[model samples]
Target: MTKLKTVVAMAAASALFLAACGSGDSSGSGGSYKLSFVQGVTGDAFYITMGCAVQEEAKKEGATVDIQGPQKFDPTQQTPVLQSVVSSRPDAILIAPTDVSAMQRPIEQATKQNIKVVLVDTTLNDPSIAASAIASDNVGGGKAAFEAIKQLAPQGGKVLVVSVQPGISTTDARAKGFQDAVKADSKFTDLGVQYSQNEPQKAAQIVTAALQKDPDIVGIFAANLFSAEGSATGVRQANKQDQVKIVGFDAGPDQVKALQDGTVQALVAQQPGKIGQVGVQQAIKALKGEKTETKVQTGFTIVTKDNLDSPEGKAALYKSSC
Candidate 1:
């Protein structure tokens, strides 16, 4: 009887222990909700920083997050990844669509599965399908890029834009904003926009050819990280670094190094971390059946060589990892 009593007490303790462990898995008032974050591409600093923020915010809410993306920023590759995530049936998904049109249908399927979808950093043509869309003011960031270039090249001359492919909503809006801003200013001549196809080599070739055609090009606005990197290299290869001023859109580590080395003049840094944080918040709100914001536009910072070490500049810079 003594042995049996001891065995029974041990069994009761084990059951309580198991129950406590299960409850500790989620601390929020609401049960744990699985979340998925799909980036425009894997290995990009901008998206990496956003993913880090998403993980941090999810942890605070006692939620679990899964981050995935394609090797390249292509809809063909991202579509498969999105479909796989949808099949897993996470409670919510946060994604940065590669192309505005191509990603529409794949994302629609997620919505049809009753998954709460949040668009972060990029959006589709039919964004109504998502619970909320959060991103920087891309058009305004482009305009700000032009403004930085104007400050670098006060006399203005011919200015050109090296951007990603046309179908990308963010880069396209950035190119338009820069071109429109240049058009408004008579001192600046818009040399038109060139597509880099998100290839650094292609962007470098484009910039080198543009410089060869018009050696007098004064300013260049690179709409994204690869474009800026290649533009800086092209200017250096042409030995025109002192002549052409470059304003890049994202403040990746490479872009900041370029600014420090005097290869680039200024950078427009978007609030990607903030975008990701808000994305998770919105997703949780939707999962909880609370009011969720349809659209949220984050802000940007203009980083230059002079203020590169400032607190704001440090905060604005993108992270390679969490």
Candidate 2:
């Protein structure tokens, strides 16, 4: 009977302890189910879109989610957030690990108490703590970027990589895949990878610096929406828009404008709205003691002017999501 009650207590977590889930304090009203959400940064439209999806799912599931994260993709900032989340001892935690290795200890601590941890939008180095991880096919997405730009520089010119956080696994994987694809193809010449750290001004600064180093850089890879916009700006400021091709990951209103203007040749867009719905579905499965897939690939697709508003493109952004 005691064991059964404990099982029920653990299972009923979301409903019984809402505050602790995200508050970093175990004390709560009790029975009000809580969830903790630690993200990279909410400012980026991509992460913001992802958070919206998670929040929507939490609402539908009637689970209280405290979503907190760094303003930028800084592990130093998110580390304390993770620690505070562990301190709260919530029923579960949804984290987008900024640095997979740095996050191991906190996740391991939560595991010791049988608390649930779900990694969304990113992954961890030690995958043991997260019951499941929902993310885009980052490597595949990067490959798509390389394929799109290969034609522009068939003979292989310099390609500058503009990115947000340099250490994040998702960005790293995508960048690596893109570089590998270019390297494997003898026709391609690799430039180098640079960091924007997801800051618009920073991205532009880095792009400007990269351009100065390689005046003939044929392509620029923006690893996310913000960096993509900045990349376009950098190209234009240098009077090289028509000469340089820019490919971006993720999309928003600004990215759309860039695409239409022919500044951003293409974008790798992921469904942010669906990411929210999927997160809810997985959480419910966990609540019901049902088996869930360890890694659910949310997926990403290439977006270009040719398909910007086509039925297929609209369909991708439709269905109540990104």
Candidate 3:
């Protein structure tokens, strides 16, 4: 009888040990998850809004999230931040890769450690390693920008694109889409694209120079928020506000103000918060061993002065903080 009691106690202890081990798997089935969100850069209203949504969604899933981002939107800066996050061994990571190629290996490292990775906002050249990639339809957004320009400058004349650096998936796609659409229409002359290196000052300089070279340039497409800000500044500095109609991407508060103040003609607003919220959902699904959509494309809103005060426009604007 004594021996039988001892055996039974050992069997119970073994079962409890196995249960504890299974609960540590980070599988959401039995344990809370730890999630990390790495943004393209810190201090951008777009990313801030996304981060806020990520936190909110993670809370709903009973998971905790830590948000990190580089000061600049550069692969070199983002890699170190990612590596540090990977070392912390979070159950999942949602990141916006700064460069399509440069960020590939660093993100792969996270996946190799068995941490589920979801690409948010921007993606890599090879995105297969990530559990999911979620972002706005940047290419379509770019084409829409051209359409807005066509409407603003109905007669059609010389046009230029102010874009961020190449190899950035989002901006690159936007530039390509706009250029392709411009080519399709013979009425407009493509003055080609200029890289802003993600600097509003550089974008301003590029715009001022381009305007000087082609004063008759009737339309301009600024591919991102900073580019839009600088393009408006450049148009103002060159005193071409009345001459050049501008269509910009991303509707931050400043961009909205620019539209209302007539600094820009129209704005392409992406659903950044939705992307973040969906990113968290996908990561949680991946952790729970559930099916996830490999590639999810969110929609955009066109914000003009006509709809600046509308419900849709207000909902589309990015938040500065949570």
Candidate 4:
């Protein structure tokens, strides 16, 4: 063949090679992978931070991600949003189900279309649809809260649990764990559990009602970020902040302030950012037909006054921005 002809043939082959390797393509060296993320609710900054984490990490993986959620923490509201997200038929769907069972059918339906489904920051009742799940060990965190409160209260007086709405696996698990832990100690009295729907104003109202029912409440535990803040608000509004000790689940700027001010004794901080990062990587692995764990526990840590300035807390706080 002539030299000119050989050069042309080589150029054609290079173009084909680039296309196959995704060198010039949009998806991860190949082309961009469109991801659909359905969060539980956008009320608290924690979930927003979770979405940010996924977006940031997806950028690193060269994957495109879209995060969506309901305006509130209501399962009924999220159900339609999840359906809409699935309709787009993206490469993968990551979700924090509003209700464990309510979201099962939709997620399972998405899975049928060969779309990868990852459960992050929470789990669903129907487990088969999930390729992998990344969430904190809420039960363990609840036990940790109980232990901390126990140390502060040699003889427990009254304890109230302020939490988000029901059916969400993460919130439910933490509330149950806190209940179990408090029950384990016969000295403690349960003042009952109330749902805040993960709204600050609603949580404050719930706390106010609980205090009205029982004036001797001494220890308060909130199951998630919004509820925790609400618990603090109620205590302050009721003028009971001086008598009660508060322990919050999940961390945020307000929760950190609550801790500093000695209002929130400690915070059971979930690794929300890590959950996002881990979920996206697992989704990538699943897309590549690699083995992924069915249950991936990103776990959590207990943050208190002692470690507020420590390297671990600072590192985690910086990463999660909580």
Best by TM-score: 3
Winner on lDDT between 2 and 3 is 3
The per-prediction tally of clashing pairs is 0, 13, 0, 6
Instruction: Give the TM-score comparing model 4 with the true structure, all chains together.
Output: 0.86
lDDT rank order: 3, 1, 4, 2
Task: Encode model 3's per-residue lDDT on 1-322: one tens digit a residue.
Answer: 0000000000000111011111146456666899999999999999999999999999999999999999999999999999999999888899999999999999998888888899999999998888888888888888888888888887899999999898999999999999999999999999999999889999999999998888899999999999999999999999989989998988888888888888898888888898999999888877777777788888888888776777776888899888
Model 1 clash pairs are none
Off by over 4 Å in 3: 1-26
Clash list (residue pairs), candidate 3: none
Error of 2 at 288 (Å): 2.9
Q: lDDT of candidate 4 vs native?
A: 0.76
Runs in model 2 with CA error above 4 Å?
1-32, 315-322
lDDT per residue (tens digit) for residues 1-322 in model 1: 0010000000000111011111121334646889999999999999999999999999998899999999999999999999999898888899999999999999999887888899998888988887788887888888888878777788879999999887888998999999999999999999999988889888899999999999999999999999999999999999998899998988899999999998988888888898899999888877776667888888888888767787877998999998
List per-prediction Cα lDDT, in the order shown. 0.85, 0.72, 0.86, 0.76
The alpha-carbon root-mean-square deviation between model 3 and the true structure, to one decimal in Å, is 14.6
RMSD of each: 15.0, 10.6, 14.6, 13.9
**Per-model TM against the reference:** 0.91, 0.83, 0.92, 0.86
After aligning candidate 1 to the native by TM-score, how far in Å is the CA of 120 from where it should be? 0.4
For candidate 2, what's the RMSD?
A: 10.6
lDDT of model 4 at position 26: 24
Error of 4 at 254 (Å): 1.7
* lDDT tens readout by residue for model 4, 80-167: 9988987887878889877788878877888877788889877787665677787877777777777767766656888988888778
